[model samples]
Target: KKVELVTQGEATELDKSLVEKITDPLTHLVRNSCDHGIEMPADRIAKGKPETGTITLVASHQGGSIVIEVRDDGRGLNREKLIKKAREKGIDAPDTMTDAEVWNLIFAPG
Candidate 1:
C-alpha cells in the first residue's frame, strides 16, 4: 500500500530534552500507523477512498502544553477483533466496555 505523510506545524519547537524523550514513542506511532493503520491500495479503492493512504502528523501549542496528533485515512480499528485478541491474551474485555477503553487494551502487556 502506498502512503503519504503530511506534517503540520513543523516549526513548532519543543525543548531538546522533551524532544529526546518523545522521539522514540513518536516514531513508534508513525511506524504503526503506516504498518497497520493504512490499508492496501485495492482495499482503499474498493472502499471509495483514494489509492494512496494519508498519514498526518500535527504539532501545536494548547495553552502551556504542546499537543501532537497523528491521523490516518484508513480503516480504523476492528472492535470485534480487538476484543477477541484481548480475551485470547487473557485480558478481560467485557462487551460493556466503551470503544476508548477497548482501544486502550492495545497498550496492555500481553
Candidate 2:
C-alpha cells in the first residue's frame, strides 16, 4: 500500500516566479510526509489509524497573500521526544516549555 495525496486549492493563481520558488520546498515537504512524518502501515494499524496515510497539499489566496499548507495523517510530532532530543543536543529545551515551543525545536541547529 502507498500513501495517498489529496490536493486542494491548486486552482488558485499565483505569480509564476513564486510558484517556481516554492516548488523545491513543497517537494521536500511531501517527501518528509512520506519518509519521516507518516508511520508505516503496521505501525499505523497498531495506533488504530487507517493503514493508508494521507498527505494534503493546499495552496490558496489568503488575505492578499499566497498561502500554502502541507498536512499529513501520521504518527505526528512528540513533544517529550523533541524536548529530550533538544536537551541531548545541548539546545536548551526547558521542561516548562509549551508544546508549540517544543515543536519549534526542529528548526534549531543540532
**How high is each candidate's TM-score?**
0.92, 0.87
Question: What lDDT tens digits, residue by residue, belong to model 2 across residues 1-110?
Answer: 46999999978998899879999989988998899788889999999999999999998887978889999998789898898899899888889998889889988886
Model 2: ten consecutive residues of lowest lDDT: 101-110
Can you write out model 1's per-residue Cα lDDT over 49-98, one digit (the tens) per residue?
99999999999999999999989998888899999999999899999999
Q: Candidate 1's error at 96, in angstroms?
A: 1.3
C-alpha lDDT of all candidate models, in order: 0.93, 0.89
In candidate 2, stretches whose alpha carbon ends up further than 4 angstroms from where it belongs are none
Candidate 1 segments whose C-alpha is farther than 4 A from its true place? none
TM-score of 1: 0.92
Model 2 error, position 84 (Å): 2.8
Cα deviation in Å at residue 79, candidate 1? 0.6
